[model samples]
Target: MPDAASNDYSMLRDAVVFLLAAIVVVPLFRHFRVNSIVGYIVAGIVIGPHGLALIRDVEGTHRLAEFGIVFMLFTIGLELSFERLKTMARYVFGLGLAQVVVTGAVLASGALIFGAGWGQAAVIGGALALSSTAFVLQLLSERGELSSHFGRVVLSVLLLQDLAVVPGLAVVTALGSEPEALAWALIVAGLKAIAALGLLLAVGRLVLRPLYRMIAETRSPELFAAATLLVVLATAWGTAAAGLSMALGAFLAGLMLAGTEYRHQIEADIRPARGLLLGLFFMSIGMLLDLATIIPQLPAIIAAVALLISSKALIAAALGWCFRLPLPVAVNAGLHLAQGGEFAFVLFSLAMGAAVLPMEMGQFLLAVVAISMTLTPLLALAGRKVQARLEQRAAGGLEALMTETEGYSDHVVIAGFGRVGRTVAQMLDARDVQWIAIDLDAKNIAQARSRGLQVFFGDAAQDAITAAAGLDRARAAVITLDNPAAAASALRNIKKKLPDIPVIVRARDASNMGELMRGGATSVMPETIESSLLLGGAVLRSLGQAESEIDEVIEFFRRDAVEGGQRAADDEQ
Candidate 1:
């Protein structure tokens, strides 16, 4: 056996090498707009035992790297609330369930046609049916597409795939065991999963808030960070011990904390760790690529990858259509989910270990999965092209409306249809003024239209949407995007097109007020200032102050807020 000192030194060296490679490669790829995932994986290939042999203990590195996925799932959970999940339940459960059933059945039949036993074929089919949630979600997020219709559909299917891991594991475990025992194994697994989830939900409901409250009361950043990790790992462990996947446990823990006041703080603390660890995870996946075996089987590998992408894409698209998604959205979602997922590694490894899959077949399938993951970014690009073409075709039918702004002269254009924008539009309507609104949310547009409001479904910041909304002839534009960056972006886009038009933009706080003003907003109303002024007025009224006195005080403060920006401008001059 190696000396302890030598082993420790070797481990340190390998870690240093991996970090160095990531630091160099990830940014280089990102600078060119490539997914950092691809960069990290390529770095692993160059430094791993299979390539330059710079890192000899690939397995050890990979084990450590798995934590990245855990961190990612935790963060993903933090973003999701029960309400959000409830809204997407039909797609998440109905469509997600269908994708797995249909994709697996078809792929399994294909495997059977290739002469594999039903048991082995089933394993292969189930494994391939799962797509890389981590890869697709991260890719969409990097592109700022997660809130888009396509992104939500992709998420629903990926979420179901993650949930399906439990039963998939059970099926693999029961495959080579007694045939009658299969039912018992599934029953036991299902009960354990329910018990684990129930316990988590109960604890989360009763204890998580108070637990965080106590930790927050300490007012120690170090303690808070540690407590966050503890919660994530503990829940992950509990679920794993309960025979469910660790990611599921982490996700549940996140969901529990999501509605808490400290959700954003928890997310902020976990992000750095998630990014680094996820990079490590991606690198480890690259290290697993067996080029020696795969190169000789290139033709077959290519065929398998093509078949998998095509079949899964078709299946997902069909499901999307059934769910009533637009053709482009449904097709894009299908492409996003076409690649095989990280769970396939777990599923295949278990199946091989249980002797349900032959050694040769298992190795080949692993290569197939790895190659498919590598092709996902490329497939995503293709999906974008397809979406663009469909969008162009749709635009052809609206060319006259898209270009004609003559009838919209002096009409107010609201850039969002959320509460703030809705309030502004209602006031305009009350005055009998003409107005049109555009919002990114389709549901919001539909709801507003149902209420007899003139709201269009499109991104306000997009030049096309703004033009379609008749920005060139509008009396003024109101920007009320909740996201500060989006608000600033819409303001700038409006100014670029109609440089002299009055644009009133909302700011989240005083800090963003100047930024929005500089972004060419005619006036920036910070929500903080407005709320404080309103509160002051309400308090004075409650204290029985005369209405005139309250009005006088409010008017003075409002004048000061507006002049504060002018004073800064004068100072700059």
Candidate 2:
């Protein structure tokens, strides 16, 4: 009854409160320079239960939140590529593993200190160990840091947290009533994961790519989309049905698709779904915060939240320094990743289901995750400022290195100039970076110099071209390349000879998450799309947005792509 009857009129009810939050707090947060997510959560709390009791039926709201998570995972899957994962193996395995072990250890200790037994304490710790991937990544993408060094490390660790949600959930579930069963269930889960992975690896190498290519050759986008969905959904279902979590299934599907030739296409298709659902996911968090219950505990809870964030940064910084990254880089990376994410929600849910944690405790933890996630944008921005300052201070010593690569006499080193670069040179009047662009086409190079922009035109992937580009001491290498592989390879080569030189590379895709961590990619911006989308959404939402229609439109587009039919009806135009 709570799930069905309550949901029936939920939409009508939600419309008003959601709007109230948007109309009031959204502008307030913007006006005060607070992160918008923080405003949204605060709004949810104000109109949520225990406040105005605007969302009287909590069950219905939770149901919609579930869809938010699903969409969130789907989008996370879209942003990943196999090669990209392999490139940041350090962050994936090392950073991720360390995060799980350390964060869990710390939380488990806290629970024990709070008077819980080992089993109970461990479950509590497990819940606390998780963070909000949806909030963290959304904020990161918004800041255009997905391809930055900080973003890569943070994402690697977060991805680990997401994957860890499976067993952690199982542990919480097992510990609730039958604590003794926890150990056995984990062993079973581990074995199942291995077998599933093996089966996927074999099938992936033999079947997936060719099948997708065959599907693509038919020029049937719907079939391609259907096949893509089938791969992920079926695998996710199989993993969950096999005594694992749905998160594992999704991650495995992404891993399996990593090596495929059609990886980009699959990523592109899934991206829009990821974007929209992601916002809803955050909104769902806003719905969950029972501010009244939390108000009295605000002081202690705020301290805990601050501790949770600060400690993680220290942990990350220590790890980065140990890895021999620049002190500035290490610190920035640490600060950028200081918060907890959505995976924490799963742990709490599992624990509640297992009865290891009381419902109130889980609710409290949700409040914590929501608060932390909402604060992420502001935190990241501040940390970025600190990082920029640190970089500037360090750059004073690196100036000679920069000058060496930028071009001593006359040269052109072009990173992605596009429209912006074209105009930059016209104002220069024969001034050049003493390096040419590493473009795929000669027409681009011709256009650059036709406007009298210093230009060299060739793929940076070639050793001959890098050599020709005067890469040895080209003053500064303006790596304006778009593709990840090309950009990364170019950076590696630049670092080979001019190891200390400053090089800037353009990062234009969210999927190119690892580009910022490459050897010589001093700056990174994975995509400008998210900001544009955010602006668009704000405009739409402000002009009396209708959730039902938005949902219908999104579902239509997704289903069209999913079913491989009616490929954009207006496409005939």
Candidate 3:
């Protein structure tokens, strides 16, 4: 009984330490415009056994930290449906396969030249061939580039790498088997994986939507959240039971729910948990770095890190180029995927346990991978800078502008191609007005382009994107970005560039209308106010109020609301 109490107290203390480290470190990194992921890692290094020794249970911490990857993959799956996956088949299968194969072969050859045996070289090459999915995805999301062309390309490669983990593990296991049994072991592993995936997909498709619908019908937020957690954990457990990675199962679970109506709610419910756990995962990665061991071999480790990053980056870029991606985009994708991935740790651990990798060599490789991951944000920043330079130098020499806005004078410029912007475009289309739209969603842009619409992919709040969209030649501009901050930014940018241009902005609620108007919007349409007015008018009509009277009442209310908002804006100014 005493031991049990002590155990509970120890766990509580560790949790507090973890939270304190994150609270202290994350904000400092954010202050300098650095990615918060770097901060989490730094925090782990500081509080970990190697540093202050506040948290000495590295293995136990790692077990909890892995849920972060599971949740991250689940959220990523929620964003992508099977249809979207099908569309990305070329990159996922072709370029992704080529990347893993070519990169693995080159690195393996290098490993062999360095006096490593075939089994060890194969393990080293395969492990380092993959890039950090969590780091890359989180960083891309932070920079708002996950929907960019290169971002999609990066995602495609990462997806394939995730899928490759099963096979990589199978190979690791095979190495420890007798030569005659090795082939059989791999075949069995592959079959088990396929069966697990098939079962999960079949069950998820038939059950997840109904389960969510039933939960949602209860109208209990807590119940709905509990159901989401259940689905994620159950799916992860099922896959792990079948000798597959838990993260893959979580992703599959998310993919199953992606096409359902409850996807957004599920995403919202899971986001906080995902962020917290994912940060812990990064911290765990940091905890793996032993400062004492690294300091003794710093120069050699640095060389290995450089070699690994450069080789992977060059291979990824060359493959992207061969797959018809632009040089700049290909290079950017390469840099984004240059680092050794989380799976490398898993594979190395397996190899070390199976006696395929020497302990000394494994520790060195682990240190190299961990350090490379820490440098990812810096590398990504460098990649963006390089891409910008390349694009600027060859701006006119590339393919025709994504949107043909050169001859579109006196056209309407829709800043966001979402539901509200789409409706506005449809109204303009009825009048035969030539208009173009700018949006950040790659999927939305693709669908619009397929229908022969002049919708281009870009951030509406950016000066360059707006200029390219011919905002100066626009007769009017509409800011319909769903995010309040984004809408305000677009309004301000448009007013700054073409001060006299009439800009209409969409606000999520009346609370945002005044700020948007003050930011130079000629008109602000608040969805909440409009929705309430419509509902009120309906109620009045149901009570037998005259149509003309109801209309007048609504008009009066709308006018009063706008005037009230303007006065509020004036008072604030």
Against the unseen true structure, what C-alpha lDDT does each candidate score? 0.84, 0.64, 0.88
lDDT of 1 by residue, 1-573 (tens): 569989989889987998899989999999998888899889888887678889888777877887787888888778878887787799988999999999999999999999999999989999999999778878876766666556777888888888888889999999979888889988999999999999988987898899889999999999999999999999988999998878888988898888889999999999999988888999999988877888999999899999999999999998888989877778878898999999999889889899999888998899899989988999899987676556445433125336444477888888888889999988998998898877765556668768866666556777877888888888899998877778878887888888999999887777667677667788888888899999999999999999999999998998788778656655554
Whole-model alpha-carbon lDDT for candidate 3: 0.88
lDDT over C-alpha atoms for residue 478 of model 3: 90
> Which parts of model 1 are misplaced by more than 4 Å?
143-153, 326-328, 378-400, 403-412, 430-436, 446-475, 495-501, 508-518, 527-536, 548-573
lDDT of 1 at 497: 83
TM-score of each: 0.87, 0.65, 0.81
Clashes of 1: 1
Clashes of each: 1, 30, 0
- Cα lDDT of model 3 by residue, 1-573, tens digit: 999999888889989999999999999999998889989999988989889989867899998898998998898888888997887899999999999999999999999999999989999999999999989998876655555567678989998898888888988988987767677877887899999999999999889988988888999999999999999999999998888889889988998898989999999999999999998999999888889999999999999999999999999999999999878778988999999999999999999999999999999999999999999998998887676556544432112343477778998889888788899999999999988887765446657778977776666777888888778888999988877877888888888889999998888888887798789889888999999999999999999999999999999999999998899899899
Off by over 4 Å in 3: 147-149, 397-502, 505-520, 524-573
The lDDT, on a scale of 0 to 1, for candidate 2 is 0.64
| Alpha-carbon RMSD of each model | 3.6, 15.1, 5.3
Best by lDDT: 3
Model 2 per-residue lDDT tens digits across residues 323-409:
766666677767666776666766667667767778776776766766777777767777666654565344321232243345443
